[model samples]
Target: MLRRLAAALLSVLLVVLAPVAAQAFVWARSSDALTLDPHVANEGPTVALIQNIYEGLTERDRAGRLGPLLAVSWRMLPEEPTVWEFKLRGGVTFQDGSRFSADDVVFSYRRAKQPNSGFSDYFASVVAIEKVDDLTVRIRTRGPNPAFVENTPAIFIMSKAWSERNGAAQIPDNATTDANFANAHANGTGAFVLVSRQPHVRTELRRNEAYWNRGHVALGIANLTYRPIPRASARVAELLSGAVDFLQDVPIQDLPRLRAQSGLTVTSGVENRTIFLGFDVASQAPRGTEAGGRNPFADLRVRRAMNIAIDRDQIQRVVMRGEALPSGIIIPPLVNGWTGELDTPPPFAPARARQLLAEAGYPEGFATTLYCPNDRYVYGEETCRALVLMLGRVGIRVKLVAQPQAEQSSALRRTPGPDLFLAGWGSPTYDSEQVFSSLYHSRDGQRGAYNATGYSDLQADEMIGKLSSEIDGGRRDALIARLWQKLRGDLIYLPLYHQMLSYAMKEAYDIPVDVSNMPKLKLVAAPTR
Candidate 1:
């Protein structure tokens, strides 16, 4: 009955008013927000919005390499990126008028070290943080964590006094619990400021007139409001009706309608984000009576079967509506040190999937709950539904369990979850190691805000460690490909697709989104008139 309803709904949603070339536009959220703090935000939707409110130490450039953000200039004192000194850009200040300095940098680092902040691992290798002066800081790491520069993506500098005074130095398990002013607030030099948040309804933010880096190459975005519309249909309707300017995660089935509409345009390509499935290897064996506590995913054959069962092309065409590209590994082609050939996502074949399952002794299939968020990415839930349907074709009985973003994230973090789930990864840091190690490294894969899969390979971990410390670009690239192949052989994860971010907009307004895909209110290039 439900399948019939879904098929019918999909049949009618081909209409969209997206422009061929997009400009400054409205964006809709399919889920509620988790946290506004830059350090603790885990979900993509949370990032899509909060990224505008904070400035990090490093960011992805148009070419997707680690470029300085707060750090004006940096030099490696050691062969590895382990020991480096960064020269901060002078004349910078926080939103509170406190001058940005080495003190603020140290304070921010300490705050990130707290368990609640969820960003400490990005800096876990830092042996010391030495304040050089008002505009410089020297960072030293004991061991080479190769992805340090890239991991700096989430290292947003904060005012020491403002945070301590506002009681946001520590983040609670939930933002609403033990409420602090910073939970619903921000004090950054970024372009946006929070106006209000209504949980499931919407979050409004306006441009910061005093944004430190106002109008460099950024489009002139000033005022922005984002509404969390749970229903993809509702988002599209609002977009088509002129109630919204931009809506991402457009249901692929609705592309026809959006294309037919005259007032809008759609811009899409292979985004650097990847959606994948993860296994919880926290336990030595899978935890369930079905296999008597045997972790089937421990076997590479089972993992490959899951991969084979996936019809990525079909999903790309029918489910994604041609808005995405199939992917195999964690890093996309856009990032630095990306090799042209390695870990190619294999094509889907149900017969091969069944054969592998039969070899793994699960010919009849197994039942497990697939955790998914109802409103995170576009058609995120539907994508999971489609996966469940596809897996069923190969004899796997996957019961879909979808929830709100906050609840779903909390559950994944709190427990191994109901066996498996669907999630996303976008490398704002633009580092392949950061994307892979942060989620797959055993030492750090405890769901400490990043490793949702809870799957770890000791070899993969060691390779990541090696790559982290390797200083040469060519050597680093070689090590990365080897590790990627190892990950694919182990089938630690089943990657689905690389996203192509599309924004539908009215012809008059404009927003600039290229390789550095962070949506910035300050960058909304508006109509000249």
Candidate 2:
């Protein structure tokens, strides 16, 4: 009995003496990264996940402001107005311990401009990339690129040594099932190292002990687990059960209950993303539409009718749970060149919509399928269902074909793709040029990589190209305003609403919600232990 009591006393002492466990943050959301390859998919979830692993010459902070990452400084040469030079950071090493240099920057630029890369549009104005020295590179544009600095954050850099050794020089095409070493593995110079990745399920990352900027940023999260719980109910349950420490995409309907729940901290902000609808405007015979061998979306009146039919207020209330800001234009108010007049949504008038449809030679509107991702945007599927009901009221019959984001993205990229689809665009550059070039411009060369709607105008394309080269800020803004005014009349896209983002986490942790909706957890300070 004396020996047992002594043993119990020793165990208690040992427990009290042990140090606190390292902070392991578990972040859960509804969608997973599409690929491990940083340059393959220009998708939000994929980009956010890869950002923790890979980094660019520049990065956007939580407030959507441009800042340096791999590069120490950058400037435009006064003598050579077309050339912008960047000074690379020294002593920075990749996760594999390989040294980073100008060669890697040049190599990454070339790779990102590959035909299969979704980020090709970002380099459309680049005339050449020249490495000046071991730590400096010069980017020569077709002209004086006003938007070049803002666009740098989207161009993630990769290790030249790693890519060559692993034969990942080319980005894998998501449209096809093309797989490369980069598709499954990664070697980047970021604050975190990818430990394991299971597509559509879970991914794990650990903090980089030898991170170059560890002193500058917080390295609180030692171990990070990313869980992609597709179902909203399951995601909330995981957070409530203490299985996940952070939840990124909280369902709108559950916001009240989650806020009232004990031991939880919830913060919300307006997101930079704008959810909108697009159609195959250029297709003569679009797929999934019963337009009697003609494209109804090609008609201006039909497009306008469909646009005004969607009640933004109703959707904001029912589908978004009063959490969304109604928008009339595709670009959110956060983006440059956005004006109050352009953002004011059109009046909801089903009667006028029916009249426009009748004028377009469709008295009892045609049937079409609305393709939308079930797990992409906030209330993506539910919004499409509501759209179906709303359009039906205006005599348009819509069959909802909601699928996973991966399948939906693939379908949208196909030539002569779906007739009607729901899509969201976030301006990483915070400029109207990004929206015009990627969404409205014709799919020629590298300009319209994401222009699935097939909407094109030569004048608009010229203006978009000029926006990249225009040096004067006022002139650029004028050009953007002109484009918005023209595009609104063209009716290429039906603006829905700007998404509002909410992040939920345990009281111990504090993670800020980024306007871009891509949070960099490494910058988050350590939670109170």
Candidate 3:
């Protein structure tokens, strides 16, 4: 009887300790994804969310190293240097059970280059995509492209049959009020499958059982839920109340308090993004301006005055709370073309700025509105308010207009965007090409999707076009340096500081901060007990 009682007790204990087969992990951030269609927006939040449901030919590892995802191997042909061949992974199927093939890659490539697609800049050098076989696809470029591999990680693949059947062949325009099948539903080969999506409120997802990388990657969380809490205080309350297991965007002011709290872990790192100010350089007579008949921002003297008027060091210390690295260039140091000389900010001299404004025929300065996204970047509104005061020191009387990121993006992309706007950029390719092509290049069908500033230069455009195909490393660096020199002199943008990111989560889970500021939950490790 004693032995039977002991065995029963052991069985009960084992049953009680058995690990749960399914548990949903909840996480929160400040902003929601703008759209589910992967090709629609190249914005960080949108891309990060879609990456959970879709995949690319390549993907960065937890350590930010590029590796194979759907494609097993890839290389540029020896004889035909412009042609790149990618070998697709076999036996992999989409969430809907459709087999992935080279045809899908070709379709995705073509679809991504569509007029409505925001990722056209990455494929500007590609002449054609040809399927050599069921699993082999060759991309022919206009010239010998060297950074093609680095660019593929952002070019996510889509199912050819599924897109066609669902009428998602054309990438939905995120800037407009339009709807499509892909806007709400997703059929991807990624580790997560979209269960339901309620924009700006909540998005729920479950692990993909048919995931090809299931055994290869740690899909610890059975289900994942994401909530976009724009308010910082509300986000912290959710985390402290145990309603949220993880928080992606930890407010800088709350970091010290949260770090001192128990049952929580806070991790931080520098993000590969730069926040800056832009002007409507192409507009002849921009809106919300006090200038008469002529665009004040079009004057080089006026742009230079605005650039040097603001003190970057003061902003980094006070506004950013020392969570940023003051940068002179747009691209972060992690990118290939960054140099110490290029990263040095101009001297902070309000007197000189005033003189320049006076020389530009604005002795009394002018009044214009500065549009900023409230919840997009860290302390975005605060930074813009600081700028309002800083520019006020000079003769420029400024008005601030702050709104959500969605509306801000729409305002910038529309015809004759804001007179002056605050924007941040993340170099997904970790190369200078990504920055120059998308931000500085002239507005066109293939490039300049993100050039909302309307700044256009034909000489810069030619150099940017050549940078895509230049094979020699030395020559490429020279070309990049020359372009940066011209742009720096032009002062098209007022260089701010590189952003830093921090994440707060329960101690039971460990998620590293990616340089791109997009954490991949699939690589997260959760405690069993």
Candidate 4:
């Protein structure tokens, strides 16, 4: 009788404290972040989640403008334009109370350039990093790189002492299912601290009371929880039932019902990303294709036929629910050097596509596989199904293989991963050179991390190499235009459309949509009830 009475009293006391905990912000999305290590993956969702826990020297604001995060000021050397100096912010401390200094900056640069790091391409031009003093550091590049600063936002800094002490000196290779100290743990100077993480289940974070920029930014959230709900309807139900405070990537089919709800606010924006299809053009006989002895994609006529078979306008209307913008170029219009002339896509002609396929020695067409992620992007699986049907009409039998983004990414990095794959590209630097060098350029040690198609051109590579050092505006723009013209004639990729993002939240809070799709919780504001 005594034990039962005590248990009942404790349960009643816990019920009273549950509502206070519900005040914590719950952010729901379709999938979980791949890793907590910032330098491991360059993917958008991974970076967005890591940005809240880790910070860089410079950051982009909600308006996509350059702003200070860890560095107070930075300038290029007058005598040596290839060298840039940055002055670190003093009195800043990491979450573990470690002092922030130039040593950490230098250490991070070195770590990010390691062979296992996927972000080595961003630092390809960086030759050396030197610490002049505790608060001053200089970085020397191989050439006068005007886009160096623009790329800094993606290079997050880590605590050198913490990493070395925890035996996490190197980034974990994300290809294999390897375990490391930093894979599920985090140590940073950002606005949030990781409290707990259960992969594919949930991640919990609490506000950092000692955050350096607490006074400069508005951090209304006291606690944050990220829950991955793969089912679209379940994610929507969570928001409608008041179980979640915010929902990112709202499905297009549910927009009307969500907008009519009383306590919900939905905001829409055009993201600076392009969805496209790539092929293994350089292979003699691409893997997992019906063509036994020859690669059909090697012929330009076959590539053009594949491009003309798809209907981007119909995809924009039916699959995307009239929310996406039909695109012809891999780079969106928001990026620099985008022109209307190069953005025109080929008209959908099934008869022409069939004729071209027969002329290219594939009279009966061929069987191939299209690897796609079901939960990574909005309607990713649905889009693939539509393409499979459209391609079948043109005598191409495409088998659709859908999996989680994590599994799909691992497959993409394997040796000759897929003959045909669906992927997306976003220029974090907001420049054409980043897209050109990484996607269009030939795969090498320093560049083309995502060029799984083996697409390479000597002329394109030469122009892309010159772009790193070019400073004149007119000359840079001219090179970009010429490169686009060359790529258009080659038909390297089948451009689909620019994605439109929808974010829904409770009416009591206001959160603006960012073009990069990184919603900083520091910008979220809540009104007192």
Candidate 5:
């Protein structure tokens, strides 16, 4: 009888102490990081995941404003108008205990500009990265760059000693299934240290006891576990069952249900990502299209027709559950140089679409494959399905080919990608130059890495190139507006809408929803009960 009573008492004590002993935060999302190497993949999930481990020269605050991280302060060189200097934060140590210095910044800059690194485009204007001293570094650009300062946050800093020792000096290209040590492992000087990672399964991170900003930031959660739940229903179920504490991408259909659940909070805001459709405009004979020996998308009339055929308002209502903001341009409002007048989507008119198609020599419309990802964007498959029906009404036959995000991204990067495909873009720099340089400019070694559409114009390229070096804010914005006007007139892409992001978490935790959809775990705070 004494033994039984003691055992029962121990069990009750464990139950009472479990919550306090294990203050872990489990976050679930639809997809996993393709690579932990910050320079390998310029993807949202990959960047967000690695951000917890990697520390950049600069970072964005909770309000999305530029702030200090690895670098304490930075300023433009007055004598050399094209140069910027950064003072590295002293007394900082990498997770492995190596002292942080300017050498690591220079090495990281060179590594990030390698051919395999997807972030090379961001540094296209950089002429040189030099170490002035152990604590100071300087970057010389081709010309005055207004966006350089804000763009630093995207370039993650890696320890030179750690990377060289691990044979990860070069980032493996994730597109070709190339694997390097950095692809699966990480070493950084951030608030969190990577404990373990199982690709497409789960990733575990523990608080860094030696974090430089320990008391400066709210580091309530001691541990974090990330689970990739591809299915929306499964993610919702995990959250509802208390198996997960936070969900990054909440489906619009479940917002109300999640909001009504006791002890749950759903924070929502418009994301910086703009979802749109692109075509192989430069391909002479694109595959998966009814047009033989020619590309129908090459015709302005057909492109305009396709643009008007998409009923953004209807998609926003039916498919998105009234959680999307319909847009006419690929750039979101959060980005610099965005104007409301320029973002007005074309009116949905099937009759007009048919007439335009007739004018483009496709009187009876044409059949084409619409490549989409099933799990990439929120309701991505459903959005493609709705697009198919909308185009069908105007006599366009759309064969929907929905695949996983990994496969879709691979296909889009190929020389001749799908004839028509859906893609979502987020401006990490929050600038129009990022959109123009990556999506609209002509494909080159430095720019147009994501221009799957094959849309290239020399004038557009020149304008974007000038926008990068233009120092005057008003002049740069005017150039941006001019480039946007040109893109609008050319109809290079069919703009859809800016995605609406909803983050569901326990009410005890207060997590702010940022436009980038990247919530820094260290900034998350849970009020004491």
Candidate 6:
């Protein structure tokens, strides 16, 4: 017994005397870092770093449960579903050493709702934000949104004083004539600080030593660098030889090689993204339009023919090598807003497409250009090439225009010009309304922003409007189903497949891992070697 006691004491002493590992780490993503500003940074290429440098009021965990970040506790008003009162945790401090308060929350949210900002979801249900006290805040919404409370705190908070000081008087939109404060420097209470940025090149983040979270893994000094390499070969070579520690879009062809490497582990899951195809129904097709221009696609027979011609099974097996599945809806099943039932097949039947095209007045198959991004989605270019080959067999000539990530985002911004393009959408808030309203809402469609294809359905728009104002559970779900069924039948957007995020890591580079998409490397809880 005495010997055992002595060993225990020695072990304790050893732990106390041992030097702790430096609380620093670097996390990598596939694309070049565009911007560190979470508000202005909308693309997946930029979100990975955004997670590291900012803290929302709350964050999601591995189980996708909402937990505390800035606010410790909150309660709903008994009188209405739209009103919520929150009590902020008092001890939190910003990276600049200022104490967190209700005032910061108010400033961040107001900026989110500003005109033309891409991040209006932060105000999707929010109507009024009131600062009741230093530690108290109240949020009034347009209606009782079930996901309101869950999404509210996670909308990366910005500092009120800092915004005015930096002349970022508005919320960030990539369209702003000048960069917002968030674009230049981060003022959030997160674990990292934005040190420097060069668009489509590299962005660096340094660990925040004065982080508000203590006694946690989030307290660590760290450096993170991101670079966008569009070529699959380059990204794979970097990962295989360890020139880069990790890459996000691990190519399906190279997964085997990554797996065989002894020093790294490949990580992946069905990411919250769905890939889809769209048609522009609101405009006339040009006379020289590819695929026989607008008239062919406008005809119901032509649209159905194109749908019938797709061979999703072949793409899944050959292109993705069983890594992804064909989809029918915009939302992935992992998300709650997903549509559960649909029937679609693959190994595309050009013969069938020909018959439909003939019936729709195109007895001779036509040709067109497919606008797609080389680096946006995983293997986006390769997938386009495969589709081009498949469609070519059916008498449809497809020209491919593949550009880098920046030009791709620029094209998406144009909305209607691209004939048919491959695009992906993931609801950051994880809701159907977030998907439907952003893409299908007429208000947005009128501006030709989210509704790139100009898809318009009055009934579908009404359902979303009703859903927005609905405070009751049963009625809202029915409205959601109505919208789901409508979109499912109209078939304007042809969902290609959902995505799974892939991560590669060295086993020893451990941090508190979760799927909430919020990243913090804290020195306080850095693991001991």
Best by TM-score: 3
Model 1 — which ten-residue stretch has the worst lDDT?
15-24
Question: What are the per-model numbers of colliding residue pairs?
Answer: 24, 0, 0, 0, 0, 18
What is the per-residue lDDT of model 1 for residues 1-529, given as tens digits with 9 covering 90 to 100? 9999988777655323322222334567566557677667555677667777777777665445567778887777655556777788777777667777788888887767666555655664667888888887877876655456666666777778888898877766665466576667877766777777776677777666676677474535555667778787888889888888876666667777776789777765566677888876555654541554577766678778889898988888888777777887766777654555653678778899999999998888787668887776656887899999998898778888888878767666554644777877776667676666567666452213566556666767777767766767789888877777776677767889877766666556554445545554555555543
Clashing pairs in 3: none
| Tens-digit lDDT string for candidate 5 (261-319) | 89999988888898999998888888899875779999999999988889999999999
**What TM-score does model 2 achieve against the real structure?**
0.96
CA lDDT of 524 in candidate 4? Answer: 70
- Any residue pairs clashing in model 2, and if so which? none
**Model 6: which ten-residue window has the lowest total lDDT?**
511-520
* Cα lDDT, all candidates: 0.70, 0.89, 0.89, 0.86, 0.87, 0.67
* lDDT for residue 94 in candidate 6, whole number 0-100: 73
lDDT of 6 at 312: 77
User: What would the per-residue lDDT of candidate 4 be over residues 390-442, giving only the tens digit for each residue?
Assistant: 99988889999888988877765554557888888889889998888777777
Candidate 2 has an lDDT of 0.89
TM-score of 6: 0.88
- lDDT for each residue of candidate 2 in 471-504, tens digit (9 for 90 to 100): 9988888888898999988988899999999999
Q: Give the C-alpha lDDT of model 6.
A: 0.67
lDDT of 6 by residue, 1-529 (tens): 9999999999999998764544334444446645555566456656656766777777766546678878888777888768888888888877777778899888877776664555664466577999999998998987776567656544777777876788776754454345655665777777777778776667777777676665465453456666666677877777666666546667888787777878777766666777777756556873335654454556676666676676777777888887777877888775665655742433355687889888877788787767787777777787788878876776767788887766666555554636677788876667777777777765451222466666777778778767766777777777777788777777777778876556665544543333433334442244455
Cα displacement (Å) at residue 367, model 3: 0.3
Q: After superposition on all CA atoms, what RMSD does each candidate show versus the true structure? A: 10.4, 3.6, 1.7, 5.9, 4.1, 3.9
Q: What lDDT is reached at residue 462 by model 4? A: 89
List residue ranges in candidate 3 displaced over 4 A: 1-22, 173-175
